[model samples]
Target: MSSTKNENCYIIKLGREASLSERANELEAAAASGNCRKLLQLIRATGSKKSDVSETICEDDGMPVTNSHRCLERWTELFEGQFN
Candidate 1:
């Protein structure tokens, strides 16, 4: 599929996403790269941000995270896809 950016896209200031979004993305990427230390930092930093992380994952289709098991499964799937 051809990539296209929506011209009408605009940020919603009414309801901003939680800060954990960035950390989650970083952690996921680091995990894919097999960075154990980064992954641990991510888990530790995720303390009070768990809810935001879960909500973001649930809402994003690219990151299918329904349950804890599914999250790990999906992460492994993505990691394997990247390596192989």
Candidate 2:
């Protein structure tokens, strides 16, 4: 589980473990182009309303899970109660 944290948001990686600093660097580099739409797209596509990106970082509860549309959808539905 990896996570990127900023003042306003946290983006967590579902499939692997990466340091917060590394995730932050990746986001910074991606944002340097002045277009973070791709970043937003990924978040909008995968984020869970209840569990949040922070969930991926705390694994003592369980190991980090993989990233797939199906997994995201299931998680979203379980957490937010909205699935379509």
Candidate 3:
């Protein structure tokens, strides 16, 4: 039934959330201990390949922005303003 499918989806989501939380805790501990290799491993494990953006761009104020989400958000705002 649809309800059973929804319950299965919810359980899967919860399992993923728990796994991410555990990885985050491990990452925090690694960072506190200055374990760069373990930190990078945890980061890579927690991050998705599809979300990886290696390109660096500049913000509107000329500050360098290397984060993909921030770059996308800035560009979206700029384009939205031009259209509106």
Candidate 4:
């Protein structure tokens, strides 16, 4: 039996995908190269100025807040206070 053009195209695509996905070890080794801190610094350095405000969130009492919920509450409070 003969396959159609779409079937042949799909088979070729699957072969290419399978070959590309076979580099698990290389991907893992690249990820474990220990450049995480540098990557984070680069991301932060390129980030917008608006994001800087949330980078060091603190409560009204002058205590640093790490909790996501508390940070959101602090942001909400600040945003709401501007209207009053």
Candidate 5:
């Protein structure tokens, strides 16, 4: 596998681990806490090619978020929607 592919796999693994651990809320919070953007940027910078890393923000419902910003939005919706 190529380096980029390896990075992608690592990210996916991280997401899966987070979801399996039932820490979606904490993950979502961390993602929306501004640091995620920086971390995402660092991850992107390490890649030789541009590829979407949104899959790294796996939703608890099995829905895949396709962008960092949208990931945050979806998490907000999922959490807040619970009350409505």
Candidate 6:
């Protein structure tokens, strides 16, 4: 981490992972924009969630599939119930 022009909001440096792909770059761009809705749309349109994992994800018959609107809705509902 290095401070610019003195201090008070120093930039934290991250060691780059050399294997980053094009899709990873796009996702990073969307994430860096700080607009959650746009990132969500990109993720939804591309179905990027859980797509890179090597593990097999077996969804139950009634469970919401990953990267879908239903999964997002289910997550929101679950969190609302938990915190409310």
How would you encode candidate 6's per-residue C-alpha lDDT over 2-77 as one tens digit per residue? 5454353332222223323555777788899887887887678667455564423324466536666666666677
Best-to-worst TM-score order: 3, 4, 1, 6, 2, 5
Comparing candidate 3 with candidate 6, which one achieves the higher lDDT?
3
Best by lDDT: 3
Count of residue pairs whose backbone atoms collide, per candidate? 0, 0, 0, 0, 0, 0
| Weakest 10 consecutive residues of candidate 2 by summed lDDT | 7-16
Q: How accurate locally is residue 12 in candidate 6, as Cα lDDT from 0 to 100? A: 25
lDDT of 1 by residue, 1-84 (tens): 223333223233322344556777888899999999989987887765545444324323665566877777776776787999
Q: What is the TM-score of each candidate against the true structure?
A: 0.35, 0.27, 0.54, 0.35, 0.26, 0.29
- Candidate 3: regions farther than 4 A off: 50-84
Candidate 5 Cα errors over 4 Å, as ranges: 1-63
The residue pairs found clashing in candidate 5 are none
RMSD of each: 18.0, 16.9, 11.5, 12.3, 17.9, 16.6
- Candidate 2 lDDT over residue span 1-84, tens digit each: 233355224334432345645565666666786668866754554455666454442133566655665466657656674543
Shift of residue 73 alpha carbon in model 2, Å: 28
TM-score: model 5 vs. ground truth: 0.26
lDDT tens digits by residue: candidate 3, 1-84: 999999999999999999888888999999999999999998887777786656666887889877878888988887898999
Clashing pairs in 2: none
Candidate 6 clashing pairs, residues 3+ apart or interchain = none
Candidate 4 CA-lDDT value:
0.71
Error of 6 at 38 (Å): 1.7
- Top of the candidates by TM-score: 3
Clashes of 6: 0
What is the C-alpha local distance difference test score of each model?
0.65, 0.54, 0.87, 0.71, 0.71, 0.60
| TM-score (C-alpha, index-matched) for candidate 2 | 0.27
